[model samples]
Target: MLVSIELVPRSKEDLLRDITIVENILPQINVLNVPDLLRFDLRSYEAASFAYSEKKDFNVIPHIRAIDIAPDAPLPCVDRPEIKEVLVVAGDPPPTEQHEVYPNTSVDIIKRYQKEAPHLRVYAVFDPYRRSPKEELEELERKKEAGASGFFTQPIFDTNLLQLSMDWLRDETVFWGISPVLGEKSRRYWERVNNIVFPKEYDFSLEGNIHFAQRMLQLVKQQNDNAYLMPLRVDLGAYLTELQSFIVY
Candidate 1:
């Protein structure tokens, strides 16, 4: 199974620093996913270009927010030979309503990319928490029909939910997301803001998060699916070292 790491596009210096850290800590991890954050100055593809410049071997999958691009304009990353894939998302609204955005949905962009750039593999986002399993699966089917070659899901906290979603997407290429929630505040943010359903005995410490990630990775291995680590608000190197040790042993 291929493992990936999510890198936030903040600045050239920060992006390179994190890439180097991941390279030194876990050389096996070659896929770096860059998300498009409207609040940040650096666009996802720009940050991904920086990463590719630093390490040619890394498979950089930059996220393209459908709302940011017009229907007629070309994607900035599609022509680049180094970038073979992209993850398209509906994207959150801009921090302020002042920024102009297109009304395009992810499905619209996916279909357009498939027709316009057949060589580039497009991916769709799967949010299990936002809708019911039945509804989300139906929407995933819609994205699949739109010519999305694969999927990348939001972080799932429950094992049963993971299993169910994995079963639902059994034959597709999926990268299950895993992130660490360090404290009660972070936990509540997931619970209230993101609608994450955590188990009653969910661990809130660093070790607890590491153990859960290991378990998730093992399950993903058993199912022959890929997994991605989104180490939000944690020491990337240390957390990856621990997770890597689990894989090594």
Candidate 2:
């Protein structure tokens, strides 16, 4: 299994610091959900430089937000030779802005990135439960047609939901399942932090969190031995460590 970490920095300095810490521990990690439309100014450049400096072979796959994909426009700066892969997401617009003002979809970005960076691999995000199985399959097909190399799902809590998605998409392309590690407090904290409204009946507990992750991993492995597991959230270190232990055994 290839273990990677998602870098969600609130600022350029924090991003650099996170990369520095990651470098000291692991050789490389995938930088997740980086906005492509942001200015490649001094601070952003410095953050990228520091990340690359830590591990020359580190794959700095920026999360290419869907909105940055302008129809027929030039590829973003992250498509440069230095970056080798990108995770394309239907990014949420900035809190202050409306998505209607955005120009492109995740597919458009994938198509442009594939053209500009022939060596770069494009990973698209899919949410199965959010839509019908047919619609999900159609979206996956659309992404593949637009040049997506792989698929990644949202933070999954139910195994059946994942199985349905995999059954529909198994023959189409490879996919990575998102297993988030958010303890009770952390989950509640993030819910508020992201302005996401949680169910009033939601129970936040460590046992619940671990059960969710373990079941998801089991289902993914059962469905396909080759399926890649991509756990989300910052506290996934424990889950990764446990996964490593299983591999060792």
Winner by lDDT: 1
lDDT of 2 by residue, 84-113 (tens): 666787766654554243677787777776
Please, what is the TM-score per model? 0.96, 0.70
What does candidate 1's lDDT look like per residue over 36-144, in tens digits?
Answer: 9988999998888888988898999999999989767887687788888999999888899888799999899999988888899999999899989789889899999
Backbone atom clashes (below 3 Å) for every candidate = 0, 0
lDDT agreement with native, every candidate? 0.90, 0.57
Model 1 misplacement above 4 A: none
Tell me each candidate's RMSD, in Å, in order: 1.4, 5.0
CA lDDT, candidate 2, residue 129: 52
